[model samples]
Target: MQYLVLASRCLIGVVFLASVSTKVAGPAAFAAFVRSVRRMLLVPSGLVKPVAGVVVAAEAAIVVLLAVPTRATAVAGFAVATGLLLAFAGAITVTVRRGTRTTCRCFGASTVPLGPAHVLRNLLLVAVAVAGGVAAPTGGSLRLGESLVAAVAGLVLGGLVTVMDDIRALFHPTPASRRH
Candidate 1:
Protein backbone atom coordinates (compact mmCIF):
# COMPACT_ATOMS: atom_id res chain seq x y z
CA MET A 1 0.00 0.00 0.00
CA GLN A 2 2.74 2.40 0.93
CA TYR A 3 4.67 1.38 -2.12
CA LEU A 4 1.61 1.98 -4.26
CA VAL A 5 1.32 5.52 -2.99
CA LEU A 6 4.99 6.06 -3.55
CA ALA A 7 4.69 4.79 -7.09
CA SER A 8 1.83 7.18 -7.76
CA ARG A 9 3.89 10.06 -6.46
CA CYS A 10 6.78 9.10 -8.69
CA LEU A 11 4.52 8.69 -11.71
CA ILE A 12 3.09 12.19 -11.32
CA GLY A 13 6.53 13.62 -10.63
CA VAL A 14 7.84 12.10 -13.81
CA VAL A 15 4.92 13.54 -15.77
CA PHE A 16 5.65 17.02 -14.44
CA LEU A 17 9.37 16.71 -15.12
CA ALA A 18 8.65 15.57 -18.66
CA SER A 19 6.32 18.53 -19.23
CA VAL A 20 8.90 20.99 -17.95
CA SER A 21 11.72 19.47 -19.96
CA THR A 22 9.71 19.66 -23.16
CA LYS A 23 8.57 23.24 -22.60
CA VAL A 24 12.02 24.43 -21.50
CA ALA A 25 13.90 22.84 -24.36
CA GLY A 26 14.71 26.18 -26.10
CA PRO A 27 13.48 29.77 -26.35
CA ALA A 28 11.77 29.42 -29.72
CA ALA A 29 10.18 26.15 -28.70
CA PHE A 30 8.89 27.75 -25.50
CA ALA A 31 7.55 30.69 -27.47
CA ALA A 32 5.69 28.31 -29.73
CA PHE A 33 4.27 26.63 -26.67
CA VAL A 34 3.16 30.03 -25.43
CA ARG A 35 1.42 30.75 -28.67
CA SER A 36 -0.38 27.43 -28.58
CA VAL A 37 -1.59 28.05 -25.06
CA ARG A 38 -2.84 31.48 -26.02
CA ARG A 39 -4.77 30.06 -28.92
CA MET A 40 -6.21 27.13 -27.03
CA LEU A 41 -7.05 29.22 -23.94
CA LEU A 42 -8.57 32.05 -25.95
CA VAL A 43 -6.66 34.48 -23.77
CA PRO A 44 -5.55 37.97 -24.69
CA SER A 45 -2.65 37.91 -27.14
CA GLY A 46 -0.46 39.92 -24.79
CA LEU A 47 -0.68 37.34 -21.99
CA VAL A 48 0.78 34.41 -23.93
CA LYS A 49 4.39 34.86 -22.85
CA PRO A 50 3.63 35.23 -19.17
CA VAL A 51 1.11 32.41 -19.24
CA ALA A 52 3.59 30.10 -20.88
CA GLY A 53 6.28 31.00 -18.36
CA VAL A 54 3.97 30.35 -15.45
CA VAL A 55 2.83 27.00 -16.85
CA VAL A 56 6.38 25.84 -17.43
CA ALA A 57 7.58 27.03 -14.04
CA ALA A 58 4.65 25.43 -12.30
CA GLU A 59 5.42 22.11 -13.93
CA ALA A 60 9.06 22.38 -12.86
CA ALA A 61 8.01 23.18 -9.32
CA ILE A 62 5.70 20.19 -9.26
CA VAL A 63 8.61 17.92 -10.13
CA VAL A 64 10.71 19.34 -7.33
CA LEU A 65 7.90 19.34 -4.80
CA LEU A 66 7.03 15.72 -5.45
CA ALA A 67 10.67 14.65 -5.53
CA VAL A 68 11.06 15.54 -1.86
CA PRO A 69 10.21 12.47 0.23
CA THR A 70 8.69 14.41 3.07
CA ARG A 71 5.02 14.09 3.94
CA ALA A 72 4.30 17.78 3.91
CA THR A 73 5.91 18.27 0.53
CA ALA A 74 4.06 15.30 -0.86
CA VAL A 75 0.77 16.81 0.23
CA ALA A 76 1.62 20.12 -1.33
CA GLY A 77 2.69 18.45 -4.58
CA PHE A 78 -0.51 16.49 -4.75
CA ALA A 79 -2.58 19.59 -4.13
CA VAL A 80 -0.81 21.56 -6.81
CA ALA A 81 -1.04 18.68 -9.25
CA THR A 82 -4.77 18.43 -8.68
CA GLY A 83 -5.21 22.11 -9.40
CA LEU A 84 -3.15 21.93 -12.57
CA LEU A 85 -5.03 18.92 -13.90
CA LEU A 86 -8.35 20.59 -13.15
CA ALA A 87 -7.29 23.70 -15.02
CA PHE A 88 -6.12 21.62 -17.98
CA ALA A 89 -9.37 19.72 -18.14
CA GLY A 90 -11.35 22.90 -17.90
CA ALA A 91 -9.40 24.51 -20.68
CA ILE A 92 -9.76 21.52 -22.97
CA THR A 93 -13.43 21.31 -22.20
CA VAL A 94 -13.89 24.91 -23.18
CA THR A 95 -12.28 24.33 -26.56
CA VAL A 96 -14.15 21.14 -27.27
CA ARG A 97 -17.56 22.36 -26.19
CA ARG A 98 -17.31 25.63 -28.01
CA GLY A 99 -16.47 23.93 -31.31
CA THR A 100 -12.97 25.31 -31.41
CA ARG A 101 -10.09 22.97 -32.06
CA THR A 102 -6.58 24.13 -31.17
CA THR A 103 -3.27 22.36 -31.01
CA CYS A 104 -1.95 21.39 -27.61
CA ARG A 105 1.62 22.42 -26.94
CA CYS A 106 1.43 20.27 -23.87
CA PHE A 107 4.77 18.53 -23.33
CA GLY A 108 6.40 20.54 -26.08
CA ALA A 109 5.14 21.28 -29.58
CA SER A 110 2.46 18.86 -30.69
CA THR A 111 0.22 18.79 -33.71
CA VAL A 112 -2.50 16.96 -31.86
CA PRO A 113 -5.59 18.98 -31.04
CA LEU A 114 -7.52 18.90 -27.78
CA GLY A 115 -10.26 16.27 -27.45
CA PRO A 116 -12.10 14.06 -25.02
CA ALA A 117 -8.95 12.04 -24.53
CA HIS A 118 -7.17 15.08 -23.17
CA VAL A 119 -9.93 15.70 -20.68
CA LEU A 120 -9.96 12.04 -19.73
CA ARG A 121 -6.22 12.11 -19.33
CA ASN A 122 -6.42 15.14 -17.07
CA LEU A 123 -9.12 13.50 -14.97
CA LEU A 124 -6.99 10.40 -14.63
CA LEU A 125 -4.10 12.49 -13.42
CA VAL A 126 -6.43 14.24 -11.03
CA ALA A 127 -7.40 10.88 -9.59
CA VAL A 128 -3.76 9.95 -9.12
CA ALA A 129 -3.05 13.21 -7.36
CA VAL A 130 -6.01 12.75 -5.08
CA ALA A 131 -4.98 9.25 -4.25
CA GLY A 132 -1.43 10.28 -3.52
CA GLY A 133 -2.54 13.14 -1.33
CA VAL A 134 -4.93 10.98 0.63
CA ALA A 135 -2.43 8.19 1.15
CA ALA A 136 1.00 9.73 0.94
CA PRO A 137 3.75 7.85 2.77
CA THR A 138 6.31 9.76 4.79
CA GLY A 139 9.06 7.15 4.95
CA GLY A 140 11.44 6.35 2.10
CA SER A 141 11.93 2.82 3.32
CA LEU A 142 10.82 -0.09 1.16
CA ARG A 143 11.53 -3.80 1.09
CA LEU A 144 13.43 -5.28 -1.84
CA GLY A 145 10.37 -6.77 -3.55
CA GLU A 146 8.26 -3.71 -2.73
CA SER A 147 10.89 -1.44 -4.15
CA LEU A 148 11.03 -3.41 -7.35
CA VAL A 149 7.27 -3.35 -7.74
CA ALA A 150 7.08 0.35 -7.03
CA ALA A 151 9.76 1.09 -9.60
CA VAL A 152 8.00 -0.93 -12.27
CA ALA A 153 4.64 0.57 -11.52
CA GLY A 154 5.98 4.08 -11.59
CA LEU A 155 7.75 3.50 -14.89
CA VAL A 156 4.72 1.98 -16.58
CA LEU A 157 2.32 4.60 -15.31
CA GLY A 158 4.66 7.42 -16.20
CA GLY A 159 5.13 6.05 -19.69
CA LEU A 160 1.40 5.80 -20.22
CA VAL A 161 0.77 9.34 -19.06
CA THR A 162 3.60 10.66 -21.20
CA VAL A 163 2.11 9.28 -24.41
CA MET A 164 -1.52 10.00 -23.73
CA ASP A 165 -1.62 12.71 -26.36
CA ASP A 166 -0.12 10.44 -28.96
CA ILE A 167 -2.66 7.79 -28.18
CA ARG A 168 -5.45 10.32 -28.42
CA ALA A 169 -4.20 11.68 -31.70
CA LEU A 170 -4.20 8.25 -33.26
CA PHE A 171 -7.83 7.64 -32.39
CA HIS A 172 -9.44 11.08 -32.32
CA PRO A 173 -9.98 12.20 -35.89
CA THR A 174 -11.94 15.36 -35.14
CA PRO A 175 -9.65 16.88 -32.52
CA ALA A 176 -9.55 20.71 -32.66
CA SER A 177 -7.02 20.78 -35.48
CA ARG A 178 -3.44 19.84 -36.05
CA ARG A 179 -2.78 23.36 -37.27
CA HIS A 180 -3.88 26.83 -36.27
Candidate 2:
Protein backbone atom coordinates (compact mmCIF):
# COMPACT_ATOMS: atom_id res chain seq x y z
CA MET A 1 0.00 0.00 0.00
CA GLN A 2 2.80 2.41 0.84
CA TYR A 3 4.49 1.55 -2.39
CA LEU A 4 1.33 2.12 -4.35
CA VAL A 5 0.68 5.46 -2.76
CA LEU A 6 4.25 6.63 -3.10
CA ALA A 7 4.45 5.50 -6.68
CA SER A 8 1.19 7.22 -7.50
CA ARG A 9 2.30 10.42 -5.82
CA CYS A 10 5.60 10.47 -7.66
CA LEU A 11 3.98 9.67 -10.98
CA ILE A 12 1.39 12.44 -10.65
CA GLY A 13 3.98 14.91 -9.46
CA VAL A 14 6.36 14.16 -12.31
CA VAL A 15 3.66 14.39 -14.97
CA PHE A 16 2.46 17.77 -13.73
CA LEU A 17 6.03 19.04 -13.41
CA ALA A 18 6.63 18.12 -17.03
CA SER A 19 3.40 19.82 -18.10
CA VAL A 20 4.01 23.02 -16.16
CA SER A 21 7.60 23.21 -17.34
CA THR A 22 6.63 23.14 -21.00
CA LYS A 23 3.87 25.73 -20.75
CA VAL A 24 6.02 28.15 -18.80
CA ALA A 25 9.25 27.45 -20.60
CA GLY A 26 9.03 30.95 -22.12
CA PRO A 27 6.60 33.69 -23.04
CA ALA A 28 6.06 32.18 -26.46
CA ALA A 29 5.30 28.73 -25.07
CA PHE A 30 2.73 30.11 -22.68
CA ALA A 31 1.14 32.25 -25.38
CA ALA A 32 0.88 29.25 -27.66
CA PHE A 33 -0.75 27.25 -24.89
CA VAL A 34 -3.23 30.02 -24.30
CA ARG A 35 -4.09 30.09 -27.98
CA SER A 36 -4.61 26.37 -27.99
CA VAL A 37 -6.85 26.60 -24.94
CA ARG A 38 -8.93 29.28 -26.59
CA ARG A 39 -9.40 27.17 -29.68
CA MET A 40 -10.03 24.01 -27.67
CA LEU A 41 -12.66 25.56 -25.39
CA LEU A 42 -14.12 28.03 -27.85
CA VAL A 43 -13.85 30.67 -25.16
CA PRO A 44 -13.95 34.39 -25.76
CA SER A 45 -10.54 35.85 -26.51
CA GLY A 46 -10.72 37.90 -23.33
CA LEU A 47 -11.03 34.87 -21.05
CA VAL A 48 -8.33 32.79 -22.72
CA LYS A 49 -5.34 34.18 -20.86
CA PRO A 50 -7.04 34.00 -17.48
CA VAL A 51 -8.20 30.47 -18.12
CA ALA A 52 -4.75 29.42 -19.19
CA GLY A 53 -3.23 31.02 -16.12
CA VAL A 54 -5.63 29.14 -13.87
CA VAL A 55 -4.81 25.87 -15.57
CA VAL A 56 -1.08 26.31 -15.19
CA ALA A 57 -1.48 27.39 -11.58
CA ALA A 58 -3.66 24.41 -10.81
CA GLU A 59 -1.10 22.07 -12.35
CA ALA A 60 1.63 23.64 -10.26
CA ALA A 61 -0.48 23.34 -7.15
CA ILE A 62 -0.95 19.64 -7.76
CA VAL A 63 2.76 19.17 -8.02
CA VAL A 64 3.38 21.01 -4.79
CA LEU A 65 0.57 19.30 -2.93
CA LEU A 66 1.72 15.86 -3.94
CA ALA A 67 5.25 16.64 -2.90
CA VAL A 68 4.21 17.01 0.72
CA PRO A 69 4.61 13.75 2.65
CA THR A 70 1.32 13.93 4.50
CA ARG A 71 -1.80 11.93 3.80
CA ALA A 72 -4.22 14.83 3.68
CA THR A 73 -2.00 16.85 1.38
CA ALA A 74 -1.39 13.91 -0.90
CA VAL A 75 -5.10 13.15 -1.11
CA ALA A 76 -5.84 16.75 -1.90
CA GLY A 77 -3.22 16.67 -4.58
CA PHE A 78 -4.76 13.54 -6.08
CA ALA A 79 -8.20 15.14 -6.05
CA VAL A 80 -6.91 18.26 -7.75
CA ALA A 81 -5.11 16.18 -10.33
CA THR A 82 -8.24 14.15 -11.02
CA GLY A 83 -10.39 17.23 -11.39
CA LEU A 84 -7.98 18.82 -13.84
CA LEU A 85 -7.63 15.65 -15.86
CA LEU A 86 -11.40 15.26 -16.11
CA ALA A 87 -11.77 18.86 -17.16
CA PHE A 88 -9.10 18.36 -19.80
CA ALA A 89 -10.79 15.17 -21.01
CA GLY A 90 -14.14 16.91 -21.27
CA ALA A 91 -12.67 19.82 -23.20
CA ILE A 92 -10.79 17.50 -25.52
CA THR A 93 -13.97 15.52 -26.15
CA VAL A 94 -15.80 18.65 -27.18
CA THR A 95 -12.97 19.77 -29.44
CA VAL A 96 -12.72 16.40 -31.17
CA ARG A 97 -16.48 16.23 -31.59
CA ARG A 98 -16.54 19.68 -33.15
CA GLY A 99 -13.82 18.52 -35.55
CA THR A 100 -11.60 21.34 -34.42
CA ARG A 101 -8.03 20.82 -35.50
CA THR A 102 -6.45 22.91 -32.77
CA THR A 103 -2.81 22.10 -32.16
CA CYS A 104 -2.15 20.45 -28.83
CA ARG A 105 0.22 22.76 -26.99
CA CYS A 106 0.23 20.22 -24.19
CA PHE A 107 3.76 19.34 -23.03
CA GLY A 108 5.53 21.92 -25.16
CA ALA A 109 5.03 22.79 -28.84
CA SER A 110 3.09 19.80 -30.03
CA THR A 111 1.83 20.42 -33.55
CA VAL A 112 -0.62 17.54 -33.29
CA PRO A 113 -4.23 18.62 -33.44
CA LEU A 114 -6.84 17.82 -30.83
CA GLY A 115 -8.08 14.26 -31.20
CA PRO A 116 -9.40 11.19 -29.38
CA ALA A 117 -5.88 10.26 -28.40
CA HIS A 118 -5.69 13.32 -26.16
CA VAL A 119 -8.97 12.40 -24.52
CA LEU A 120 -7.76 8.87 -23.88
CA ARG A 121 -4.53 10.12 -22.36
CA ASN A 122 -6.34 12.41 -19.95
CA LEU A 123 -8.68 9.62 -18.92
CA LEU A 124 -5.73 7.41 -18.16
CA LEU A 125 -4.25 10.04 -15.91
CA VAL A 126 -7.55 10.37 -14.10
CA ALA A 127 -7.43 6.65 -13.36
CA VAL A 128 -3.99 7.05 -11.83
CA ALA A 129 -5.22 9.88 -9.63
CA VAL A 130 -8.15 7.85 -8.38
CA ALA A 131 -6.03 4.84 -7.65
CA GLY A 132 -3.54 6.98 -5.75
CA GLY A 133 -6.26 8.67 -3.77
CA VAL A 134 -7.85 5.40 -2.80
CA ALA A 135 -4.62 3.80 -1.72
CA ALA A 136 -3.16 6.77 0.09
CA PRO A 137 -2.13 6.08 3.65
CA THR A 138 -2.79 8.32 6.61
CA GLY A 139 0.84 8.11 7.75
CA GLY A 140 3.60 5.78 6.78
CA SER A 141 7.27 5.67 5.92
CA LEU A 142 8.98 3.57 3.33
CA ARG A 143 12.40 2.02 3.85
CA LEU A 144 15.35 3.20 1.78
CA GLY A 145 15.22 0.28 -0.64
CA GLU A 146 11.45 0.51 -0.98
CA SER A 147 11.65 4.23 -1.50
CA LEU A 148 14.17 3.89 -4.27
CA VAL A 149 12.16 1.18 -6.01
CA ALA A 150 8.88 3.07 -5.83
CA ALA A 151 10.47 6.30 -6.97
CA VAL A 152 12.09 4.69 -9.96
CA ALA A 153 8.87 2.96 -10.97
CA GLY A 154 6.86 6.14 -10.67
CA LEU A 155 9.39 8.24 -12.56
CA VAL A 156 9.56 5.80 -15.43
CA LEU A 157 5.79 5.52 -15.69
CA GLY A 158 5.41 9.28 -15.56
CA GLY A 159 8.06 9.78 -18.21
CA LEU A 160 6.34 7.29 -20.50
CA VAL A 161 2.95 8.95 -20.00
CA THR A 162 4.35 12.39 -20.70
CA VAL A 163 5.82 11.27 -24.01
CA MET A 164 2.97 9.05 -25.15
CA ASP A 165 2.27 11.23 -28.15
CA ASP A 166 5.80 10.74 -29.37
CA ILE A 167 5.53 7.01 -28.77
CA ARG A 168 2.35 6.81 -30.83
CA ALA A 169 3.86 8.80 -33.64
CA LEU A 170 6.74 6.37 -33.74
CA PHE A 171 4.39 3.45 -34.27
CA HIS A 172 2.15 5.24 -36.76
CA PRO A 173 4.53 7.17 -38.96
CA THR A 174 3.20 8.86 -42.08
CA PRO A 175 3.11 6.60 -45.08
CA ALA A 176 5.82 6.92 -47.75
CA SER A 177 3.21 7.69 -50.41
CA ARG A 178 2.06 10.74 -48.41
CA ARG A 179 5.58 12.16 -48.25
CA HIS A 180 5.67 12.80 -51.98
Q: In lDDT terms, which candidate is top?
A: 2
Which residue pairs in candidate 2 collide?
Answer: none
When superposed on Cα atoms, how far off is each prediction in RMSD?
2.8, 2.9
| Candidate 1 lDDT tens digits, 1-180 | 568678878899888888888888888888788877877756778887887788787888888888887888888898999999899899899988988877777776667777787899899999988998888754556798987788688868887788776665567654443333
Q: After superposition, how far is residue 179 of candidate 1 from its true place, in Å?
A: 12
lDDT of 2 by residue, 1-180 (tens): 888889899999999999999999999889889888888766788999999999999999999999998898889999999999999999889889988878777777666676888898899889989999988855576798998899899999999988877777788765321211
Decoy 2 TM-score against native:
0.92
For candidate 1, list the clashing residue pairs, or say none.
Answer: 101-176
Candidate 1 has its poorest 10 consecutive residues by lDDT at 171-180
Candidate 1: where is the Cα deviation over 4 Å?
A: 137-141, 168-180
